[model samples]
Target chain A: MWLIKHIPPMAKALICFTFVLVITSVLIWLLNPVIIPVLVSLALYVCLLPLHDWLTNLGWRRDMSAMAILFLMMFVVLVPGSLILAEFNEQAMLWQSKASIAGQSLNELLGLLSEKLAQWQFHIEVDQLKANILAGLVKDNGSFLSSISSLVMSISSSLLLVPFITFFLLRDFESLRNKSLNSLPNKYFELGWLMYFKVAKQTQGYVRAVLIQQSILAVVAASGFWLAGFDSPVILGLIAGVLGLIPYVGPALGLLPPFYLVLANPEVGFDAMYTAVLVIGVAYLVDNLLVIPLVVARFANLHPLVALLSIIVFGNFFGILGMIAAIPLLAISNIVFYQLLLSFSPKKFTTNVASFH
Target chain B: MAGSPFWQNLFRPDHKQKKHVRDLWLATPIFSGVSANQCQQLVNDMAIRRYENTEAVFKLGDVGIGTGLIISGSVRICMGEKVLAQLEEGDFFGEVALVIEAPRTATAIAAGDTQIVFFLRPQLESLLSRSPRQGAKIMQNLAKVMANRLGSTNTLLEQSHVAD
Candidate 1:
């Protein structure tokens, strides 16, 4: 009671805010499963704004532009994505079929191996282990297929959510921002405005640069693959190009499907792998060196590690939506937190803020 | 720069005939991507206007209805006797006239013999509609201008405190 009487209002507010953060973190951790999809939708919104702009500039109205973007997302992202899934499943099934077809052949080899092992006095039962593993896989096939079907259904639903959220975000962003800004408490109003606007500029610059660079990479990769006579060359280029947006992990994730496709084919897989790998490596290098450095980082300047951390921390606290929202969240928070410190802090802090803003 | 090839004559451009095409091409930012020949060709679609030294190009109360760019020499933006800003070669003027069709806000005078390439609002509008990139570039420049103005105002406020 004595402490409550003495504690200042601002200090009390800060304490209250801290408590809110803790509670929010708890809530987000619980709700992450649903929140992650919304986060994915928001990422699509940020990444796709420039495409919408380009189409609108070309004389398509906003609604038409939104429709065009949705269509492109379906064909470029969803269709190819679904095809890759079906294709991978087909290859996996072939491998599964071969496991059975090659089962008799495998038993014979295992018998020869066990004989050689027994000859060497190494009592390892190679034939028995192979038979046991095959039996387990056969028993689990029903559960495995059911799970795969569920995964496919959820992905298709998420794909549909992206365009729905994206169209609204793109259309109503300015009004939403204005309304939110007006809602800030009077004491913090100016700081909030400056922080939000600065963050908006950085986000806009990043989204703009990435969209432009990714589109260029997609066309170039698609064209090169097309020239190389790879089946679904456009598909390869698109997968590689869009995945390049994910920072370090994106490029690695993009490489897998193509590798599978290569391994499946008899004559073309190796060449396709080599070409796809080269294109992706070069595209990755260009994106890191030229596109990101010259364009996004000049304004944003948050390194890949920092960006990744922001995603993880924010995602953990805010759910996956927080992860997707992390970059912009960090941008605005840096501004607001610093600005608050500035009013009473040293002059040097203000200078850094000036240059950054 | 557009009509008068050798601006070496620091006194003034002798021809003083505004090259419409040159000014139009230079007035835009996105046109930076256009080929040199194409820029020249665009200038041919424009009209030129001349301003005399120390004469008012447009005043705070004057009626004005065109958009243009400085082709040669410069203009001083003034409020009464105090010079508020400078517009040098390649600097644009009368932009607000295109944007809002508003009356002049301040007096613009030729600091020296000035020639400008201009297009009536309708012609300028038509040209911009055909080239959205160029138009967006112009809008970007306009944002830059407004930002610079905001910076100057902050500096002025600081200077006022220093004088006190």
Candidate 2:
């Protein structure tokens, strides 16, 4: 009798879990095409809202101010960013070509060694294992470059689309919010709006803080690279800025490229390696010791494990945008999803704050 | 103040309960008779505005479109390019336009990097409709303001006559 009673609850929980997972998967898959641009526009709108509020206070006409800010974004960030990205495109292609040659040479060398070792060892699987490892590495490099280039191309093509949507978003933002809030079922409107604001405030705060950390790291890393006698110092710096977005693994990944560039050159090899290592050290200390705790910790209220998981899952579903946005979106979803789960059932969670606005 | 953790705050389920505008006591002659509830309602309805130093709020005759509540900042209310008054927190102006739905008579500019609460005409209309008692108190407040302006005009006229 006791087991029977609990079975229903267990079954209900399983059903709910399946239902949520299905819905989330469907939503992410269906929204895949427009997801990135929409997300980028969302971020742009959020970052610029403070400026819009300032201009409104100055009593500059809203339309005029919004338009001016749009142009400013293009001039100050996007255009220069695109030009720099073009250089990265060329560099990425060059790196792939060289890395492929190196990879193939290494694979052949390994194959010969594995074959010789297998003949001598009598009954070993060395050759097969070597082949598997070589295949995996080759597959990874090819896919990585292809995916990155496609992303860059898509971003550039859709670049014009962002400002148009962003301007409208900023312009009609408040009125749209009011209408949406008011139109919700009367019983839910106030709570829903409160939740909306809370999520927005938290997400904005986190992104702002993280972006500041990225910029500071970018400058510091770039300066280190410049001093290291690296070619394309500015480009390396810009790359550092973008990589700085990826939290823990970003700095580590960033170290590889400069390290390789140094390794490839004979004259500046050891010195370059040492400098790149130093750059990563300084960057890591700045981020973890001071920046992460002081800046990102306040805004991004979720724990690091949660942050990392969000990036992995979201990136799996939505690619780059997911990678950039996983933390904030997860934080928001954690609250909203938990609230929905609780309200629809009698099982209230201990951490009510996670879901309650 | 970057990266500041959120300080805990007590949540008021209903902000309106905490204020009664009519019971207000302040140095400004304009709000003398208003109730605490009315003042609170006005504060709730007030729109936020912010500006940096040397930023202009509005140009003269740009249709004094909305009322302002000096929420936590200051500004210069100019008339035909003359510096008519420099107002600070708790001060309000351009209210006449919202009352009568008229073009702005003066351009209010920010004297320094400032923040103000703006009350647009349509929003004010909705707010007034929401509370008739508060609306009446605001009308009374407006009458006192008009009387003060008239008394100032009369004094200016008397001084001009003496100079002549």
Candidate 3:
């Protein structure tokens, strides 16, 4: 106890930060299943709260208004989503079969190239290389299929959980906020409440802006692909849009499917590959120049390095979902950290002043 | 009398205590013209604080962000060593911070064990954005409260000048 009492303030702060980080990481891992749904619901609640308030002001009961909003979401978002999912599933199955055939063709092409090089006195193990390539493709495809299935399961569960959670959140928002604020010790109460509002505002803006950006990009990608005469333009565009959730590298990933599709089809020829590149290039340009500058950049407002590092760190731990969640999480943590610094500094300065006196 | 129902009722105030809080908020001039639902909503965002005897609610020159409504005890407002006023239940203080960011002009110390409810500026701003009509009413009410305080201050100044 004496040693602990003798520890420097900076060291104590560091210890506290490390303890909090470790506990948060453990809690996230343990509550992984519920955490995503809860987070998504919170975002939805923020977006829908204004509308819910308006309705309630118009003399509607809280629960009734919440139910009305949920039904509106079902019709406007979920029903169309179900239709799109059905169509995408059909296209995906077809693409999977075609992918296997394409893999074989790639193996043959590699073999032919290796043979041609051998005639020039360069020896290469074409068979071994082709076998290895095929094995890798099969393994990758297996993992991809598993990941997709898991994603679908999680999404379906979220669909059920989101509205249910959002309803309660909207109805009890004021009381819930009060309860949370009241729980803070009196010394921290005012600052804690301010931090909460700041974090909420930042996160709500970020989530809404991201959703708008994604939708615009999806439409742009679909139109570009369709105009370029790509097979399954809708699915390819949707994939591009979804993958575009990752910053920096996302558009590049979105470009790969079209490149592969063009390369694998002999009838389309090499010239079509340039068209595919042109379409994706245009989409990428529009996304970065227009959508990002106007929407995401305005809302997120993080340093590029910080954004990139967050994506790398979060992606390492939580994969694609973490990559998508990284920006908002960083924004929230930034607000909380700065507010804590502000709140603590005055106390520290007072202590120093007293010591000097 | 020890086992009487009235004794039990006196010791344990029922859930009607919450309603009493709502009624108290309703009677405040700052919340004038607000509907019952709006009152309930406002109350939901407020937090009650308890202060021990002689405890400082806030010191003079400290930065503050909201006003405090006295609920169950008295508080003494002071400027340095001089006591300016003693306020009891239903009275509010620190309202100047709600309209502007400024250092507090006076210290507010609880005269006894006291309970106060805080209504923060940010909470009011959020309410404004969510419901403009109700927000307008609150702003108008705040203006009236400030105007009345200004009038009283002018009267006090005039009386002091006459004495001089």
Candidate 4:
């Protein structure tokens, strides 16, 4: 007891940090199954909360309002999602055949390029390079296909639980929040309340902005591709829009499918490839110049480097879903960490300020 | 009475809690003229906290973000070593903090074992966003409360000057 009481403050802080880390890791591991649904519900709840409140203010019952929102989601999101999945599956099969044909063409193109380069005295092993590239592509695609199927299975199972969880969250979120707040001890109450408010505001704004940005990009890309006479305009547009959720490298990745399509189809011609590139270029311009500045940048406000690093780190841990969620998660953590520091070390913080002054 | 099951059941309030909380909100000045449904919505955002005797509700210089309504006990508001006021059931303190981000002007301590309901600023902002009319009513009431406090403070100041 004496030793414990006499422990250095730095040691005590280290112990506290370790304790919090262990607890967080354990909780995350235990709750991994439900985490995605719960997080999705939270995002949905933040987006829909104003509507829910308006309905309740109009004298509609809480349960009734929640039900209305749930039905609206089913019609607006779920219906269209299913349609897109169906279209995407059809496109996937078509692409599988086209991919083999494209491999052959790629080999021919590489051979011609290698011959031209040989005239310039640049030695190149065209066949070996083609074989290595094709094998790598096939392996990557196989892994991606397997991962996609497992992801779908997990999502389908969790989708069943989402609506139910969302309803309760919408109906009872205020009470639940209050209950949580009431449980905080006096020492932590102010910090907890501040952190909760900041994190919620930041996260809700980020998610709302991202959704709006994605939707607008999808529509614009789809329209541009369709007007340019690209086959599977909707599929291409959807892929572009979805991939655009990743910052920095997403737009470039979005260009690949249409580029591959142009290369694979002899009928598409060089004109079609140029048109595809132009359309993607226009979309990229609109995204960076208009949608991002007006809709997303104000809310996200993340440094480009931070956003890129978060995508890499989160993508490593959670794959595609992690990459998609990285920005908002990083924003929340930043707010929480800043608040924690302000709250826990006010004296030291004040002393530093005083010294500066 | 503390151990009596009948008393416990009466106080426990399983089914009637919502109605009870709504009624309690209705009796408060800030919630007056608000509809029962609106009151219920407000009540949903309130947290009920229990404090032991002599426990601090809030300390001077702490960041204040909400108002606390006395529910079943008394609280003493103090500045430095001087008691400013003793508040009882239905009285509220720190209301100005709910509307503005600032530090607590005084410390509030429970005079006895107490129950208080808190109405936090974020919830109030949400209420304003959802229903401006209801939010306006509460804001108007809050304005009146502040005006009344200012009037009293002015009178005290005037009296002090006259005495000097």
- Considering every candidate listed, which one attains the maximal TM-score? 4
Residue A295 deviation, candidate 3, in Å? 4.3
Candidate 1 docking: what grade? Answer: incorrect
- Candidate 1: misplaced stretches above 4 Å? A1-164, A266-272, A303-337, A343-357, B1-164
Over A1-357, each residue of candidate 1 has an lDDT whose tens digit, in order, gives 999756665565466456545765798778666554565566677777667766766777768888777777778877877776666455446545445544454465567778888988877666677666445433254332223333344555576676667777767664466445434432333344444545555666666676678777777777776776766766567666655555445566556545544544535635566877876677677777866677645754677788787766764564322443566556545554444444322221211111101
Superposition-based RMSD of candidate 1 using all C-alpha atoms, in angstroms: 16.6
Comparing 1 and 4 by DockQ, which wins?
Answer: 4
**Estimated TM-score for each candidate:** 0.45, 0.57, 0.78, 0.82
Which candidate, 1 or 3, has the higher lDDT? Answer: 3
Cα lDDT for residue B114, model 4?
78
Model 2 misplaced stretches (Cα beyond 4 Å): A1-31, A104-142, A263-271, A316-320, A338-357, B1-164
Residue by residue across A16-68, what tens digits does model 4's lDDT show? 55665587679878989888778777777878887897898788989999999
True lDDT of residue B9, candidate 2 = 13
User: Best by DockQ, which number?
Assistant: 4
Regarding DockQ, does 2 or 3 come out ahead?
Answer: 3
- What local lDDT does model 2 show for residue A231? 75
Clashes of each: 5, 17, 0, 0
Measured by lDDT, the strongest candidate is 4
Instruction: Show what share of the native A-B interface contacts model 1 retains.
Output: 0.00
* Cα distance off (Å), candidate 1, residue B138: 16
Instruction: Give the local distance difference test score of model 2.
Output: 0.60
Clashing pairs in 1: B20-B46, B20-B47, B21-B43, B21-B44, B22-B43
Q: After best superposition, candidate 2 residue B86: deviation in angstroms?
A: 44
